[model samples]
Target: MKQLSLNDIQAAAARLRGKAVVTPLLSNIELNRRAEAEIYIKPENLQHIGAFKFRGAYNRLSQFSEQQRQAGAVAFSSGNHAQGVALAAKMLGMPATIVMPKDAPAVKVAGTKSLGAEIRFYDRWQESREEIAQDISEQTGKVVVPAYDDLDIMAGQGTCGLECVEQLQEMGMTAEVFLCPVGGGGLIAGLSTAVKALVPSVKVLGVEPDLFDDHLHSKKAGSRQKIEGTPESICDALLAPMPGKLTWSVNSRTVDEFLSVTDAEVEEAVRFAFRYLKLVVEPGGAVALAALLSG
Candidate 1:
């Protein structure tokens, strides 16, 4: 298990300065009244490409060498990561090729294409995205940018946690519990590492759709576990078949627990975000809030 230190997160934060959005932690009076705790929401849905993934993608992409940048890069994602990589590459003036599922949200696909990346679609159930990405990399000599399996990506994602802590302190508060959605576990793994180091008592929990609870099961089993059947979740961004080996290494040590929410609960949470919070969160991005609300 590779361990990510606090230094790594700080370095990532430094690198992301003036690049990534310092997403505000929003506090609603009604939300706090209902939760019985001071509930603050980190609205990454407003992030570049409408998700937190841009943090890691830009972090990783910016570090590419001049040669690597010229060769271009390839990534595999259903939606969020695709847009992340595409936008990051565009910002860096590098060509990007993204392998995405054919059924991915049209909005996301259009978002990626709008960023000047070439799109290659594959069947979600019938084809392996990794294989397709690998083939593209081999043929074009483009480097494959993994969505969640690499340490740099995890460190970049850790910037979110670092920001959360800084923002909380500025507001004269400390988080007792930090909830975040988990798919391949990079987001939670990075967040857990940073939060635990900054505030040891803060509990960092990973939330996932009930049908795609590989992280939940893996945490309980004390090993990385892959789902047996097709992951049938409405949260397209949270449907990784299993947690990444590297992400699991960090998550297994830093994350305190895991939570699972149903699709119905997620839909209601999305509605809640829209109706009350005036935020538009996709199904996957709402899972953590769903878990927090159901509690």
Candidate 2:
């Protein structure tokens, strides 16, 4: 059982200094009016690789020894994490191989390839991406960088929460709630850990795609639960099959509740971000906001 402390998150913040992008906490009066609450959004879309995954990817890979760096790294993701690992490896001057679903968005595939990572496509419906990554690791002797299941990765993701808390304090305000998007639960797990430690009273909420509500089910069951079948949804990044074991350990304790958003709601949220917030966001990136706006 690996327990994460605020110190771990702080240490990650220290490591990410001058490395990770410090995305802003943006709010719109229109959004506040609709949600009936002063909602602040941390838009990781501005982060490198166009997602928050880069923070964890770089945090985990940067700690590799000289020998490990030389040997290279491997990882599996639908899209965002693949791009994150590829870009991080490129920045660190290490070779990378990414196992990605065949149906992963084309733009993300091109982004990963542009970073010079070797891409292996798998059938998400028929093949196990974890097994593929393990086989690649065994054969190539590359370090397997799991997207969300590692301690360093979670700690790295926690930096997002750390920044949010600090930014709020700087604004002379305290948040009453935090809504985070969840796939395999890395972001929310680390985020909840930081928020719970810094502001104990804030309600930490996890939002998932309605078609893929594994987190909601897992919370109700008091254990990790897997979604069956490949349900179609516009939120491709949120199609993760199950909650990560280590991520669940932290999420079960720190997360206060879980919410699910529909594809239509996510589309609306994306439009809102562009029209009002003046930011471009993907469907998965907007689900947490979607939950709030839909209410």
Tell me the whole-model lDDT of each prediction, alpha carbons only.
Answer: 0.91, 0.92
Residue runs of model 2 more than 4 Å from their true location after superposition = none
Pick the lDDT winner. 2
Tens-digit per-residue lDDT, 1-295, candidate 1: 4578789889888888998889999988877877888889999988888998999998899999999999888999988889999989999999999999999999999999999999999998899999999999999989999999988888889999999999999988889999999999988888888999999999988999999899989988989998987658899899898899899888888888899999999998999899889999999999988997788
Error of 2 at 146 (Å): 0.7
lDDT of 2 by residue, 1-295 (tens): 6598889889888888888899999888999899887888998999998999999998899999999999899999988999999988999999999999998999999999999999999999999888999999999989999989998999999999999999999999999999999998999988999988999999999999998999899999999899897689999888887999999999998998999999999999999999998899999999998999898
TM-score of 1: 0.98
Instruction: Supply candidate 2's per-residue lDDT for 20.
Output: 89
Q: Which ranges of candidate 1 are over 4 A from the true structure?
A: none
Give each model's clash number: 0, 0
